[model samples]
Structure formats: structure tokens, C-alpha cells
Target: MIQQYGSGEPVRLFTAGLHGDEWETTSRLLEQLSPPRTGTLLLMPKVSDNEYLSTLDRDYYTTYAPHLLRAIKTYRPTIYLELHSYSKESYAALTGDGRFERYGVPAYIDIEAGILMGSVSPRIRKDFFTPNDLCVSFEMPKGPNEQSLSVICSLLDVVKECWSRQGFVAYMSRHYPQQTAVAVKNYLRFYGHLY
Candidate 1:
């Protein structure tokens, strides 16, 4: 587990490697682990094991949901950052972090096109996916690509500016129509805060 510095406040749960193959997120989040910032932070470098990692399709919890769920139940974080690398692009790409409404944060902003949203669903429980908290599936940063770091940072900056008010499921349901509120609510009930 990785933490920042601080306590008694909203916490951010930064994670990577729901799919074992996406290794960059693991490296980045690992570097971020320090103490707790504000309330508490639980960082899991690789929630899924190598066995599942080698597979083509993977589920966040079913594959490695137990470990990740345990952590979430133990610590109810304010923000969940699901980081991963895009597989479609070998070098360059950019995807809009679309959302259901323009309230503030984009539902699924893309940090890097080359990254994929390997399986982050199982990590979130029903309660956390409420109106207050938000989840961002960040595309891993590209060292050099069609999209510059500055551009990605700007998008992230915008999300950061609005994250306090937006909800993750609302934003996602827009672009991914299948991501209904009902499904989100149901998923949370089954997989959320696994203490």
C-alpha cells in the first residue's frame, strides 16, 4: 500500500496494473507512495497477479478483486485514480475524457491514447460511486507523442478543478452508454468498501 502525507481529510486512492501487463502505472504510483496526504491513501501497484495479467480480457476484482476490494473496504478514499497504458497506439493518441454532463469534470479523459482501461470496475463499491466522490481512468503519460504532456496536463488540471463536485459514474455513462447508474450502483453494492 502507498500513502502521501496528512490525515483527517478526503483521501485519494491511486492505483495501477489492474492488468498485469500495463506496467507503467505500477512504476508511477509506486513512486507516489510516501505517507498519507489529508485523510488516507491506498495505492496498489498491481491489483492483478501475473497469471491474469497474461490473459487478454481481465476483470478488476474477479481477477484480482479480493486484494483491491480489501483495501477499499479498509479505507474509504475520496478519489480513485485508475491508471493504465493504452494498447491501441504504439506511439501517439488522445481521447476526450467525456462525461454525462458538462458539470465540471470530463467522464473519461484520456491522458494517453496508447493506454487501455484494463479493468478497474471491481475496485469500487456502491457507496463510493455516489455524487460526492469521483473516479478518473487516466491514460498513462507518453514521454513523446502526438499529444504533448502540457496538453494532457491542461485537461487534468481542468478535471482537478472540477473533481470535487463531479461523480465518476455520471461522467462515464455519457460516453459509455452501457455504464448505467443502475449498473454502477449495483456494482458498488457487491464490490464496494469490502471491509
Candidate 2:
């Protein structure tokens, strides 16, 4: 259910398979990850087998996965990265510049990495982690691909190297100014804080 690797502060939690349909792809991505050299990496390859529970729906997860809730409270992760998938049809809506957005937060397309990333809302963060913790979700197009896999690995490296809130923000701000802003706004809008 939950596998932990490495050790120390700034614990990072990676979860996949909150929804049954997307579990296969998400879990595969999780499998590719190696343990971090520093800090703890908590991997939950399958959060729930019930196709009904979704991270987007707060009540579904809260009601169906008490064990997950327990794990979060027990571990107190510094960063929670939820892996999910999207349909090809919805790709434009996610990455488009139009006002219509599926996730409420601005999504960015890393053309070279072939991944779409957005911040999970503060509502979800509040339910699972402290206000200062970083919570984000990465969506791929319904399958495991090399580019996305590499990007996810790179993310873990960043988390391991920059294991503090301030350090992580500085890294993002220096390299990914736009995405950093979107993430900050997404967190701040809903009683989320980074201190």
C-alpha cells in the first residue's frame, strides 16, 4: 500500500491510482522512480481500487480512504505529488490560454518533457497536508511515456536537493517563473501558505 525509502526531514509523498481507470498508468510511473538519496520518499502506488474515489472530489477520498488519511497524518509529508492522467480530448482545455480551465489553476505544457503540471487546490492540500507543504499533480495522456517519466524523475531530484519550502520555491522561481507563480496563486487562494 505504502512504501517508504531513504530517510530524514522534508518527507515527500508520491501517490497514484486514486481512480481505478487511471491507476495502471499512474502506478507504472511511480514504479520507475528510484529512492531519493536524501530525505524520505513515501510511495503509494494504489490509493484506492474503487473507481469512484477521486482527488478532485474531496468527499469521495475522505469517505472512502481513511487509511490514506491516516498515512498522511502519520507521515506528515513536506510535499505531496499526486499522479493522474487526462484524456487526449481534454489536452487543449488544460494547456490552452483560454479562460476555460479544467483544474482551476493554470496548467503548463513542457513541450520538451511532454508533461502537463498544475497545482492541486488548497482544499485538497488542507485535507491532506499542512498549509506550507507543496501539493501538485501531474497529468499525462493516459499512458506511460519516456519523456514524462524522465520529468517526474527530475522532479524527485529537485525535491531531494531542495527539501525545504523556501529552497524549493527559490529553485522554481529561478528556473520556472511562470509555473511558480501559478502554483503560489493556487495555494494562496485557498488558505494555503508557504513559510
Q: Tell me the tens digit of each residue's lDDT in model 1 across 1-195.
A: 544445555666666666656654344544544554235555676665464342223454545455766666667766666655545453222333232232222233332333323223432534445535665565554353645434434433333333353444444466445544544544344335553
Which ranges of candidate 2 are over 4 A from the true structure?
A: 93-112, 190-195
Would you list the C-alpha lDDT of every candidate in the order shown? Answer: 0.47, 0.69
Error of 2 at 82 (Å): 0.7
Could you tell me the TM-score of candidate 2?
0.78
Off by over 4 Å in 1: 29-37, 52-59, 89-128, 141-163, 166-195
Candidate 1: lDDT over CA atoms?
0.47
Candidate 2 lDDT over residue span 1-195, tens digit each: 899888887788888777767787778667767888788899998888785554556565467777777787899888888777777786877677562254454444442355677666444565666656777677776764777777766765676555766777788788778777766664465443343
The candidate scoring highest on TM-score is 2
**176 Cα displacement, candidate 1 (Å):** 19
Candidate 2, residue 74: Cα displacement in angstroms equals: 1.4
Clashes of each: 21, 0
Clashing residue pairs in candidate 2, if any? none
Best by the lDDT measure = 2
Model 1 reaches what TM-score against the true structure?
A: 0.53
